[model samples]
Target: MRQTELSITVPATANLGAGLPGATLSRRLGMVTVRDSRPINPNTWTVTVTSTPFITGAGSATQTIPTSRVSYWSGPAVRHTGGGNLAPGQPTSAQAQTLTVPRIAFRKTSGNANNRVSWEPTLVIAIPSGAVTGLYRGTVTHSVS
Candidate 1:
């Protein structure tokens, strides 16, 4: 299973309150979950934010009020690896996989439509040679703003 790439899915829903009457809140939601593959295998992971304030609409303020790009997520991939770590100014031993959301319908502030977002993430975990053996733990955040 080392070379066989695995697949994971991350779902997202946009919610806006009191948004501009003519503006749209629809934005693409993407996510990537990271895991550690370091114990006797690996077990550590990290989430890094590359960009924020993604926009998608007509009013120009599309996704600004309360919008943000997804960092990395968590998945079963962490069970096999310890998810690499960044010490001081060094390269990480492991990497956090990325999840991309190419499509999502934003909930305009005026529209009383359901705008709650929830998603399940899938991650690829790699096992290193000198990993330790132990119980690892982590968490998954559904929203940012």
Candidate 2:
């Protein structure tokens, strides 16, 4: 088995809230390092996450309905590819992605050069009615292929 170890690192992380349906808030995840097999070329991937409470806003604070929703735009992903943005490319194969909340069966799509890159878990933390606010936090469990 050919072993070529590479490192993955994400700079900015994003966690957003859709007040209505158009508004968006981009939060940075972080860097990552995987000690596993690396892919020879870039591949296609899809990222999916479980519905969980992420960031905190207010305690039982009823606010307006958000506009935009949470999204992961690979482009302008905080990396210098020498060419341009390498967005929506491959996060599932990222090296590192900082997480705060606790989730289950959550998956995201990313790229992999050495499987040691950090990733940004763009979680969509929704604020529901009668929800116990005040820094409602948890964790998100990730899985890659």
The C-alpha RMSD of each candidate to the native structure, in angstroms, is 20.3, 9.1
Worst 10 residues of 2 by lDDT: 99-108
Off by more than 4 A, model 1: 1-112
lDDT of 2: 0.34
Candidate 1, run of 10 with poorest lDDT: 104-113
C-alpha lDDT score of every prediction, in listed order: 0.26, 0.34
Estimated TM-score per prediction? Answer: 0.23, 0.36
* TM-score, cand. 1 vs. native: 0.23
Report lDDT (Cα) of residue 96, candidate 1. 33
In model 1, what is the error at residue 132, expressed in angstroms?
A: 1.4
Off by over 4 Å in 2: 1-26, 32-48, 51-76, 80-121
Error of 2 at 126 (Å): 3.1
Candidate 1 yields a Cα-based lDDT of 0.26
Q: Tens digits of per-residue lDDT for model 2 on 9-122?
A: 333333332343233334445433223344545532223333233445652234322212222322223323222123333344342222332222222234444332334444
lDDT of 1 at 61: 35
